[model samples]
Target: MKRISLCLLLTSFVITPFVQASNTESASLDHAQVTYVQATQSQNGSWCFNTQVHHNDQGWKHYADAWQVLDLQGNVLGERKLLHPHDNEQPFTRSLCNVQIKPDLQKVVIRAKCNDHGWGDKTVTVNLLSETGKGFKVTRNNK
Candidate 1:
């Protein structure tokens, strides 16, 4: 009985820190952040954006749920909803295709949100003119 009790105590001591670290790591996912955004114009003049999002993603309960393209006025031009948690794929890049950018519009912002944390405060802006210049160019914004 004494040996069994001592073994259990030792095991718990070794496991407790790991468990606590895991919980801390998981809890950090409460806020989802958009790390980067790359915008490119297609041959048809439509715009497509690949956005990199970083989140803790503790399963479906908490994750970077979606990303959106908005005009300067905060009008949502396009949105990409993440179907599931990317727990194994931290800082993943997802693309929003076939986005129509009006000829008059020069810039757009990309924003990210999490299931539990809502929209992140940081946003990335892409300049349409510079991106769709003489030839197709990749405009990257690191936020």
Candidate 2:
């Protein structure tokens, strides 16, 4: 009886491992300043684009009218309007644009200018947001 009980106990313990569910790791990143996250891949699969911009400034009129888009190669793809009306006092602004994340891409850059004549321009760099890679942990990823 002792031998039979010992075998049963061991079998029960061994079976538990296979019964437990396995967790799958998500290919994603999360953060407070991650107001936006995109894992979009282009049809050609040449690059992966992930972008995040925040309006975290205070006491300032926006000084710039355009939002420049740059690829991992630092080439200017295009530029668009800041989207918000001229505001000099919007205590904060966040995520000026969404990113088209292509596959196999490595880096992306963007630029934003505050309306305040006294304030300098903002250049944001988002790196390694590609598949199988880690993204930025944003706190003030504001531009």
Candidate 3:
């Protein structure tokens, strides 16, 4: 009986960390998040951006529903709505094309929202001048 009890206690100690780690990983994904964003300008002067959103899309009930591009002033320039849950496709990239951006605007931000959790606090910013002049540089926003 003593050996059995010790074995059980050791097993729990070995397994508890794994269980907690799994739960933490799942909880992090449960919230809608923008992992990455890439912006590019087309020949016609319009802009296109690809945003990567990570979410624990369980179903219609919980999913990353949309992402948007906004100027510094918070004016929405373009939005891409996710029609369905990306349950299997965690951290997926979606693209918005032909976005009309003013030439005078220097920067833009990207954000995503989930059906259950509202908008995520994180955002990504792109420098239009660098993207247009030299090459595109993707910047991550933790806030």
RMSD of 2: 15.1
* Candidate 2 runs further than 4 Å off: 1-62, 88-102, 114-121, 128-143
Best candidate according to lDDT: 3
The collision pairs in model 3 are none
Candidates 2 and 3 compared by TM-score, better number: 3
- Candidate 3, residues 1-143, lDDT tens digits: the string is 99999999999999999999976754576667777777877777788888899888998988999999999999999999999999899889999988998878889888889998788766777786663322236432222
Model 2, position 55, has a per-residue lDDT of 43
Lowest lDDT block of 10, candidate 3: 133-142
Ranking by lDDT: 3, 1, 2
Q: What is the Å distance of residue 104 in model 1 from its true position?
A: 1.5
Model 1 segments more than 4 A misplaced: 1-29, 131-143
TM-score of 1: 0.71
Models, CA RMSD each: 12.2, 15.1, 9.6
User: Residue 57, candidate 1: how far off, in angstroms?
Assistant: 0.7
Global lDDT scores for all candidate models? 0.81, 0.42, 0.81
User: In terms of TM-score, which candidate is strongest?
Assistant: 3
What TM-score fits each model? Answer: 0.71, 0.36, 0.72
